[model samples]
Target: MAKYLILIYGDERRWDAETEPERAAKGAAHEAFRRAAGEGLLGGHELEPASTATTLRSATGTAPTPTDGPFLETKEALGGYYVVEAPDLDAVLALAARLPELASGHGGVEVRPIVEHG
Candidate 1:
């Protein structure tokens, strides 16, 4: 089996404006996804808002510099992620398609396999 990382990206401002009921519905969807993913769901988590992110940069010969926000300015930001074990890319995509992001049309999932070291 291979491990895949499913990165969730979204517009943070829209997410922030969501009402309590909308948020609850999203949570319920996640619960359903978790149940359906079953053993394939290795781990998952929702990240803190992008405003809380700390980015780091290192110059060729300088110590790493810490920054207060995401490294790039974009409409979409990484909002959360999940790591799962699957037999192939098809299986991973099938599971990723069930994530709430794609259903909401606000965001989508990027699926990539993990590189394993012998």
Candidate 2:
């Protein structure tokens, strides 16, 4: 099986404003996804808000400079991710399409193959 990384992007502002019940609903959805994925689910995590993020950048010959926030300014910020092992891209895509973020209509998923180094 091949491995894929599923990146979940969403509106941080909206997510922050969600009520406790709303958050619980979304969490339950994620649990359902985990159950569906079963053996195919490798690993996953939900991140803290982008405000807590630190970005580090370095030039070819300079020391790395740390910034206070995300690497880019955008309406959507990465909220979570899942790494899964699947038979192929199609199989992974099918799994990704079931993500709660997509159903919420405030987010989207990106799937990328993990490069294997020998």
Candidate 3:
């Protein structure tokens, strides 16, 4: 089995714009995923904070620095992610499609494989 990271990207700002019902729905979605994930339906996962993140880089500009917020300028950022062990990317994509948080609305989900380091 291959380990993949299901990155959930979206407009964090829009979360504030969502109505009460919308927020509730999102919460419910999260709960559902948690339950499923615990049951081996989902391998392992985590939900990160909003797009406003800290990015640091070297002072000499050797590497991009992280400060109070994200390095990239975009409406949708890497808000959260899920780590799952699946057969392949397609299997992960199928899981991605089922995520309401990444469903049609704010942004899209990105499927990527993880590299192990000794």
Candidate 4:
């Protein structure tokens, strides 16, 4: 099986402003996804807001520099991710389509196969 990473992106401001019920709904949706993924869900996590992020950059001939925040400033930020083992890209895409972020229309998911080193 090939391993794929499912990256979840969303607008932090909108997510923070969500009402309790709306937040709960999103949580439920995630729960549903978790159940559906089952054994296919190798690992996953919800990240803290982008504001809490720290980034590191390295120069061609210098030590790495540390910065406080995401690498890029964008309306949408990576909010979470999941690592799953699937037969192929098609299989992972099918599972990604069920992500709640797609339903919200505020963000989307990206699936990329993990490169294996033999």
Clash totals for all models, in order?
A: 0, 0, 8, 0
Error of 3 at 60 (Å): 5.9
Q: Candidate 2, residues 1-118: lDDT per residue as tens digits?
A: 9999999999998888989998998899889888888998999999999999999999999999999999989999999999999999999998888887897778999999999998
lDDT of each: 0.89, 0.92, 0.71, 0.92
What TM-scores do the predictions have? 0.94, 0.94, 0.75, 0.95
Candidate with maximal TM-score = 4
Residue pairs clashing in model 4 are: none
lDDT (10s digit) by residue, model 3, range 1-118: 7877878777767765789998788778867766655533444454455444677778674876568866768787776677777777776687677777666488788888889787
In model 3, which residue pairs have backbone atoms overlapping below 3 Å?
55-65, 55-66, 55-67, 56-65, 56-66, 57-64, 57-65, 57-66
Please give the range of 10 consecutive residues that has the lowest summed lDDT in model 1: 97-106
Tell me how far the alpha carbon of residue 84 in candidate 1 is from the true structure, in angstroms, after superposition. 0.4
RMSD of each: 1.0, 1.0, 3.2, 0.9
- The positional error of residue 101 in candidate 1, measured at the CA in angstroms, is 1.1
Off by over 4 Å in 1: none
Model 3 weakest 10-residue run by lDDT: 38-47
Better of 2 and 3 by lDDT: 2
Q: Which stretches of candidate 2 lie over 4 Å from their true place?
A: none
Estimate the overall C-alpha local distance difference test score of candidate 3.
0.71
Return the TM-score for candidate 2, rounded to 2 decimals.
0.94
